[model samples]
Target: MTECDDTHGCDTISRRAALTGALAILASATARPALAQTYPTRVMQLIVPFAAGGGVDVVVRVVAEAAGDILKQRLVIENRGGAGTVLGSQAVAKAEPDGYTLLAAPTTMVINPALRSSLPFDWKTDLVPVAMIAKLPFVVTSGLKLPAKTMKELEALGKTRGTPITFGSGGANTVAHLAGEVFGLVSGAPVLHVAYRGEAPALTDSMSGNIDVMFSTLAGASAHVKAGTLRALGVTTAKRTSLLPDVPTVAEQGYAGYDLSAWVALVAPKNTPPAVVATLNAAVNGALAKPEIAARLIEIGAEPAPDTTAALASFMAKDAQTWAGVIKAAGIKGE
Candidate 1:
């Protein structure tokens, strides 16, 4: 036999080679659990792309606690807020695909691509959807100083004000900011967009009567509305939120099609095993089904909708199409 064949020959193999093969097999057998089955042998990190108090972070913490129950391990949340969630998203995208690293992303997941031409990571391709947790309807609220009580009245007042009404938003390219822009487009109202560091700063300015109006997730403005600091004119969603059931939707108020809501979802790095994704997704769905979880989400003006990866993907694509057109038409250049 040729030397090459002999080297790999079954019968010609040396006792030393046999011993080496046996040791390699033994090592693999011992390492299998650490590499696979022992997944999350420690705490898994879920990176929230926004500040701690935001809607996305709030919902994630709720889901994390519930999911943790099933996993029997702590699901730690890390807040990496900045650059409109890009920083956190990029960090998760580059993380190892061992399912230990996850991302708590917002509806901005789809909108960011349309806003910025060059992103650090490909959101659609790099992030694998684990669960679509819930959606927080955008509230069209104004400072208590604004006289308008309804969307139509707000439009008329905008005309009477003459100058484009300036509105405070969480940040540029955020869902609330984009929703305000869309509202302006549909209502034919002149609104000059103003970006803020976060909802708190924006609401503070709104409460101070410095800003005329603001678009925010219901959770951010719910307490302010209860305290009479801000006036809720209408929600920017198809259906009225349970938290603000008395308030009409923008569509019901005047605009025919003014539904815009921001969502929170869980995702892992691309290439994560499907089984792992399903396990996490199932946990989230189960958590949302809990009465306590649903009740808490309702209190925040959010609707619980634990959906599959396919459903999340389809919704994201639709959101991307809708907002991409709006962003492009409005010429929203990113920072």
Candidate 2:
């Protein structure tokens, strides 16, 4: 009789625990969908960290248009350019993580935290990566009149020159700027780093011979390269870009193991509902995979690298480590 009483008590405890577990699961399942469905009840904003007409801006516009179509809402782009993207980044960092405020950020999103000492928000804790949109290839472009035709020849020129070659960057603490410094460190050359407000001004300076050389994105500088204004010496990736198929990669051009491919990605504030994040990620992945989107990206010298939130998180973490090493090696510190 005592054994029976004990057994009945055990059963009662097990049933109670089961009932509690089921209630918790039901609550979680119900809450997530409700939160996701209520998201973006108004117009959505896509924040671009750089000025308009830049490669990032172009990629953001493409995705924003497609996302608007998918979400049945007007997705607008807000340009908030300053402080090597800190101004814009902080804006997104502070926004409510409801899937309504999105950030169309670039590789600087990773670079900034490692290089800059003062930041308004912590990138790791504040931002949640949604997806990777495109991988941007960098080309070593020179004015048409410059004599260096290849990476080898360019390195030789820099070595022979009594002074450091002045290299223009899209901005201070940007991937382009860091690439120039990395090349300098690896090749044993003195590369004078020059910071520009944006890629357009830098490319313009490169085209008109105002700057000696620069690491310009294929998407932003290809038109000038094709127009005979700027000459492509070598691509800054491990493999040659399709837009400039004939141009050899920096590694192929005697700079072995050289690569610097920046990418554009979508991110939002943290704690956004998994379902809405999943939905946006799927839409972005699908749109990027479309032949039309892929072709347009290729035409503009951008490589589509679409992936889910998990993949993007891994990629972003790896990118952070890579840029951290580069920043330390180059001794690049922010103001």
Candidate 3:
């Protein structure tokens, strides 16, 4: 063999490497569509960051069940409630970026980051919003025995009470807790927060007169309000909800812009394929469009709020900002 010059051999190797890389890229581009098209070969896990039987869990189960039918695959619900939603949320954040693992969380997903200085994962960076399922306005409810029957009366009573008026929350830094803090800020009342394990316990305490006030989801407090166990002062929405049509909103009740509600949405670990996100978003919206699913959600005091991925992402960003301001103003701390 003739002696090979160094330049010629190196140039040939580089060209071959470049060609191989080009072919590999082309193959990957071709495979992505196929993978997205044939996704969900296995069951999908929808992790609810709250306990079963709570408002979020109940609503998600209904929507997930419907969406599962539309996607023609099982969407299994796994409740991982603890640490004010941090436990379950962290699980999803650390899970593989594959579409198989999903998070079905409430507003707490956004609120936690604002209230806590240190979190296991950064929600804004690690979790990608897939779809918004529903939103439920909070009903400012009081124990039946409380002297206040209206928001104004509650504020007056809270100001005059020898001890700070106690408000029950599902947990520290939860939406309910933040709502109560907002109410206190707007009304200039001295309020004490009582944290519970979940909404069920908070509602139970409210009904038993153990707590003076609770900003509870319409679903969690409606039955008690209707049964005369809890009194509805005002709803935490800009307008009255159809489920509680007779109740006035906090905005209309002299608190001109007091709108706070709990919302549920689906999110996945960052880097989940865009095609998978699109597939899930389409399935969620399709399920929300079904009259049966809509009716059931409304019956439980939730409004179907299916939206595009970009819209949900923007909404969550704004929501987080709003809550961050509120938390900072109120000096709220996380558990």
Candidate 4:
């Protein structure tokens, strides 16, 4: 064999390696779409970043079956609640961007980063929106004994009693908590915030007249309102819900833009393939559109709001902006 020059051999090998790498990258790029097409070869995990019996968990269980059926695969829900949803969310944010692991995120997903500092993942970028599964607005509720029936009435009563309005919430910096704070800001009232372990206990206190008022979930407050244990002053959404059509919205009550809602969304880790995102979004929307499924969600207080991936992204961005303003004005911090 003829001997090769050292520099020429080195250059030749380097060029060959570079070409091999380029071809490998090209092959990978080519395979992704096909791979996305055949996604969900196995069970998919939808993590509920709250306790098993919480609102997020209930919503996930409601839609998981139909969505799984749509994709021809099983969707498993895993509860990883702790650190105010950080523990479970971090798992999803750092999970492989392969579309298998997803987060059934809630309003807390947008509230946590601003309420807490130095989070392990960047809330703005670490995860991507896949679909908005359900949304339900809060209800301004009071105990049967409270004289106030509207937000303004509560404010005026507080002044007449020579005391600030007492409001209880599930926790500090929660959507309910901040909604009360925002109500105070817009209504020009001195509001006292009492934090409880969860919304259930706070609502229990509200019905007992221990607290003057609470911004509560429509689901949690609906039964009480119907039973005459709690009075629904106003809905916190832009418009009244059909379930409570007779109850007017806070916006219609004179706070023209005072609207807030609690919702659950589906999200995947950053860099999850767009084709995979599209597939999952379709699955979720199909699941929600079913009449039985829609009825179930409505019974639980969340109205099915099947959404496009782009719309979900815009919704989350707007949600974050809205809560950021509330959090800043309230001087709230996380545990």
Candidate 5:
């Protein structure tokens, strides 16, 4: 009688334990979707890795404002510009991966790792791509009297000039700098680089005949090109930018296969929930698809590029590899 009573008690306890385990699993499964649904119950922050009034900053604010409406939460912009975008980037990388903090990452994030051995964060591991917001084409602009209207003429001048041709950029290892180096490598022209505080100053110096040319931003140089102060020799991308439709591409100008452009994307700190990533991606792509949003981006020289997170990841990986090769060949170093 005693043995039978003990077995019955043990079975009853085991059944209760099993019931508890099942309920716990069921709760966990439902909790994640609930968390995603309730995300952004408050304001979120977007870190712009550049200063205010910059192209990236403007582009991010436009889309962020639209996305805020969709999510019913305000997305605030904070500019933490310093150390070649490293300061702002590290701020986001170390932020809590709770989907509230994000980085308005530019192409420089990918190239910086390859250019410098030590960085506060590892882009590959510390940050993850959320969405590809837009891409802007670059242009090769020269002073009106630089003695070269086309890239071929420029190459000949480089050969004949007593000193190597000087190409100025906003800073060392920036997209403009790399594009300038690429031009030299492909054309076999002896080129030297001049780094300035910013593209505006570099373009200023180029206008004064301090530099031979500049692989520059179309947005910043377009007005001068239109004003006849700066002559745009060629567009750097594979296709010509509509903003400067009259200019030919470097490839079309007989430098075939030479194509480059700068891009911007949204990135999040590591370990941010996948559901959060999905939500942000949807918001960003939706914002990009809106007609007004697209128009605004176009007005600023950015091509609206709404894409899946997976596509962004693949594109960035390939771009990083390409930049690594270019930086290595050009012997590019950090600022």
Candidate 6:
């Protein structure tokens, strides 16, 4: 072969490499839509960042079961509870940005970042909201041994008692814990926070009178309230919940603007295809729209709060901002 100029040979090689890269990128872009169109070729994993049988797990199981049916694909739930949801959340955050892996994130998704100084992953950048499943309000419950029957009475008792009133939470930086912090902030009571592995244990301690009070999700605390083991003082919502319509709201109980509820939403790893997000959102909303699912959610003390992806993103942003202020003001820290 004839000898070639050094610049021409190098330029030709560079042009070939550039064209190859562009073609590869174009192929990836074209493949994503097709992949999204036929998503869930196999079973998908939905991670619940809480222990099994807890409020979030229960509600997510229900919704996922129904949604899986709608999608005609099996949605396996994987409970990866630890580190106040940081463990499981980070798993989802770092997972492949495909539709196969999803997260059933609760209020702690935002609260954890708010209470902690640094996280292994960035909540704002590592995860993307897909759909909002439900809003489960907290019920301020006290053991029968506590000498308080209402929110005002509880506040008064905490103030007048010689010893600091003890409040139990699922864990530090959890929604229940933050709710207790908010109570302390507004009520000016000397409250002691006792952290446990999970809500079930803390609720058990509350019922056994080891703890005086708990700001628990309605699903976890309603049974005890109905059985008269724990007395419900008020719900942590702006309005009364259908599950406990007789009980008043914390906002109405002299703590205006104390509307904190544990909400569950579906999220995927960042950069998941938009088409996949839309598909999953539609599936979730369809499941929530089912009459039986809605009724069951209500019975379990959750309200089906299906929303579009954009709306869920806005809601999550606002929620994170609100809790950031609360955490900073109350000097809350992660464990």
Give the candidate number with the greatest lDDT. 6
Two-way TM-score contest, 2 vs 5, winner? 2
Residue-level lDDT of model 4, residues 1-335, one tens digit each, is: 33345778878988999999999999888786787679989889988876565444666798999999999999999887656677788999999999999998878888887877668897679999999989867888999899898877887897788888999866666678888888887887788999765567788899899999988777667778888889999989998887788899988978888878888899999999888998999999999999999998888677899989999899899988878877786676555
- Choose the strongest candidate by TM-score: 2
Better of 1 and 2 by TM-score: 2
Off by over 4 Å in 5: 1-30, 197-210, 227-229, 329-335
lDDT of each: 0.82, 0.83, 0.87, 0.83, 0.86, 0.87
Residue pairs in clash, model 4: none
Q: Per-residue lDDT for 39-100 in model 3, tens only?
A: 87889999887766667878899999998988789999998888888889899999998999
Q: What are the models' TM-scores?
A: 0.84, 0.87, 0.87, 0.78, 0.83, 0.86
Model 6, runs deviating above 4 Å? 1-33, 331-335
CA lDDT, candidate 4, residue 144: 84
Give lDDT tens digits, candidate 2, residues 204-226: 88888887898888888887888
Displacement of the residue 230 alpha carbon in candidate 1, Å: 2.0
lDDT of 5 by residue, 1-335 (tens): 66347887878888998999999999989887777799989999999876665556667899999989998999999977767778888999999999999999989889998888789999889999999988978888888778889999999999997778899876667787789888888898899999765566787888888899987767667778888899999999998888888999999988898988888899999999988998999999999999999998887678999999999999999999988887887666654
RMSD of each: 5.4, 4.7, 5.3, 6.2, 3.9, 6.6
Q: What is the lDDT of residue 272 in candidate 4?
A: 92
Better of 2 and 3 by TM-score: 2
Span of ten consecutive residues with least summed lDDT in model 6: 1-10
lDDT of 1 by residue, 33-122 (tens): 444445656889999877667666677788789888877788999988778778888999999988899998787778888878789999
